[model samples]
Target: MAENVVIEINNLAKYFPITSGLFFKKKVAEVKAVDGVSFAIHRGETLGLVGESGCGKTTVGKCVLQLYRATSGEVIFEGKNLCDLNENQLRPLRRKLQVVFQDPYDSLNPRFTAADIIGEPLQINSDIRGSDFDRRIAELLDIVGLAPYMADRYPHEFSGGQRQRLGVARALALQPEFIVCDEPLSALDVSIQAQIINLLDDLQDKFGIAYLFISHDLSVVRHMSDRVGVMYLGKMMELSERDEIYKSPLHPYTQALLSAVPIPDPAVEEKRKVIVLKGEVPSPINPPSGCVFHPRCPKAFDDCSKLIPQLKDAGSGHEVACLLYKTSWP
Candidate 1:
């Protein structure tokens, strides 16, 4: 791993067992939610993960945070392999890693006041209490653009955007080095989405926090990410710098995904070739042989159905997994 890398994932896999029986439930099959995914997040840089629902984007984030124990492979945080650590061993390191879930309404505890919600982490991780804790809560509220007076109110009192901002404040309360933002803006209004995105940018600039921003919105991902990784059927199809991936997508899946992002100009949108992918995503439990994306890929060749392609560098830090680019990668 690089010296500046905050998180490094190597061949990470998470499988959920499917069982069926009358009296004795035997393991029927395993759903390969995340299969052989690898990537690294550097300090202060945002890595955007974009994929359709059930593509295991959320599973990857949870695995990195150790919320879900990986079925195989390593999640290396800083220099330590998180998969090797037990719950007790991981407790101290929890403060360094955090997550902001997709639904702000569901994530925030209604029973607790805003001050208590943000202050809880501080209480658990440190000894700050009394006036110091209150001060810290007020500071966090200010950082997330919420008024200090709102601290005494409950989550129900705030609007959707304000609630999401409160969630951000709580995530930052512990001063984490890395955060997994799991579709943080998907639930908010279009107007509010920009505000949260800008707030995240400002927070990153001030705190030097690295983010694994997971979303299905390509436009938002392109704006916030320094680099982007595209996944399909639990496998990473491509990984490259944001502009590189957007401008010259190497994988068939990536190309199709980017083509679907609506152009701003009416003329440009009409002129552009829309690559509409046919067929539904394959079941993870019984994914197609060889390349998982072969079933729906318009450009898939004979080799795509017979041999699985390994992700390798195509050049200039662009990594792609596809038979077409096999010769380009060494």
Candidate 2:
């Protein structure tokens, strides 16, 4: 792991057991949600995770925050392995790691007032109460662009955007260093999504918060991420700097994904080739042999089906996993 790395995920793997049967006999079939993912998030950096649905993007984020217990590997945060930490040991570190879930409405408690919801974490972990808690809640609400008076309202009273703002406020209340933003804008209207993205950017600038922003929206990822990692079938197909990945994608999967992003200009849209991938993503329980992406990869050949490709730097900081860059040997 590199020095000054805020979060390091080494060979992280999270698998959900697929069980079938009635009462006594349950057979186990594993769903490899996140498999052997290794990456590090430097201090105060946003690493955008982009992929299609069920591509293990959310799983990776959840694992980083220790929400899902890793079957194997190390999640090192601030020089401590989160996987090894017991409940008591993880309690203190919880303040430094937080999450803004996908659905804001579902995430917030319907019964509790927004104030209580935001203050819940602080109350649970510390001796704060009464005036101090009230002040902190108010501050957090204001930070996320919510009015101080709106703290008394339930989640139902607020619009979708407002509910998301409350979620952001709750995440901020802990003054966390790293946050897993799991598709934070996916549920919002396009107009509101821009606002939330801007708010996140501003917050990062002001507080230097590191973010693991998981989303399927490539354009949004490009706007928000310093570097981006593309995942497919529980594996990383490509990882590179934001601009580099967008401008010159190396991997076939990455290229196809980028080509699908709608171009604003008519001329550019007309000129760009549409690289539609064939078939569907294979079941995680039974991924294809050699290269998992070979079935859908446009550039895939005989070698792709017989040999697994390693993620290697092609040029600059761009890393790709494909046989295109690999030399044929006798």
Candidate 3:
């Protein structure tokens, strides 16, 4: 796995400044969107990051994509720390690190036709123009399950699923090594969701593209990811192989999250016990001391409120952050 790693993140953290006063605004506090989170994505492997809304799943993706500069920590991609590079230094690497946002329409320009939208990346990054550009556009559309004829149509003219396909095509235009899928299925219908999932799966198989798949949907993550990492309040609760984590979650937070996902079988669903967490998520500006999840964690101990646990491996590459486990990890 070490040799196969395409990207490595070490103690990654992103803190958004919170200020007061409109004109003379000054940094008062910070929203710790990502705090000391660390993980790696292997070549052609999809790493799923799942969490409740505002728990920093998207922030982690942004940090990996270098869309959001980290306050501290390393995001090593292509042998350089992305957070350390300026826009000029990072421009050449942009094509290799593409992203497919949650909202298809919002991420795309309504004024531009589908052809122009997909061709924009090519137009700026590549010297391919005229007939060559046209052929590339058609090829990309076909690759994403869209017809070449639909290239001339506007985003509004296409259905939701088609627009998403269009988004996927644009991401593929650069033939990137890695792609950040930021809740790409959240805005689509359930039926449409499956199509997109399969499309992404097929694309990865064909191109060997690594993906940092961020979503709130547990089932989709389970299906798409080789490994899954569960996050809560800007900290990772657990990380493991998909089957192992789902079958035997070490963290209480992970247990709660998996319990919430409904089983398809009636007999299994009827017998399954749902873990209903208590209280609402605390504010990021004033997060609780020690373990951020202790407030809602059912198995939280007295030390959980005073001692923050670092992610420690609990055998076979499964890592968890909880005071209940007495282990050391570096």
Question: Best candidate, lDDT-wise?
Answer: 1
lDDT of 3 by residue, 1-330 (tens): 378888899999889999999899999999988899999999899999999999999999888888888889998987898889999999999999999999999999999999999999998999999999999999999999999999999999999999999999999999999999999999999999999999999999999999999999999999999999999888888999999998999999999989999999999999999999999989888889888898999998788878888898988899998877786322
The per-prediction CA RMSD against the true structure, in angstroms, equals: 1.3, 1.8, 1.3
Single out the weakest 10-residue window by summed lDDT for candidate 2: 321-330
lDDT of 2 by residue, 1-330 (tens): 677688999888999987877886675889999888877888789999999999999889888888888999999987899999998999899989999988999999999999989988988877879898888888898899999999899999999999999999889887899999999999999999999999999999999899999999999999999999999998888889998889888888889998988899999999988898999999999989888898998877888788877767777767777778862211
State the lDDT at 172 in candidate 3: 97
Pick the winner on TM-score between candidates 2 and 3.
3
Runs with alpha carbons beyond 4 Å of true place in candidate 1: 327-330
Give candidate 3 regions above 4 Å deviation: 328-330
lDDT of each residue in 261-321, candidate 1, tens digit only: 8989999899888899999999999999988999999998888888888888999999999
Model 1, poorest ten-residue lDDT window? 321-330
Worst 10 residues of 3 by lDDT: 321-330
Q: What TM-score against the true fold does each predicted structure earn?
A: 0.98, 0.96, 0.98
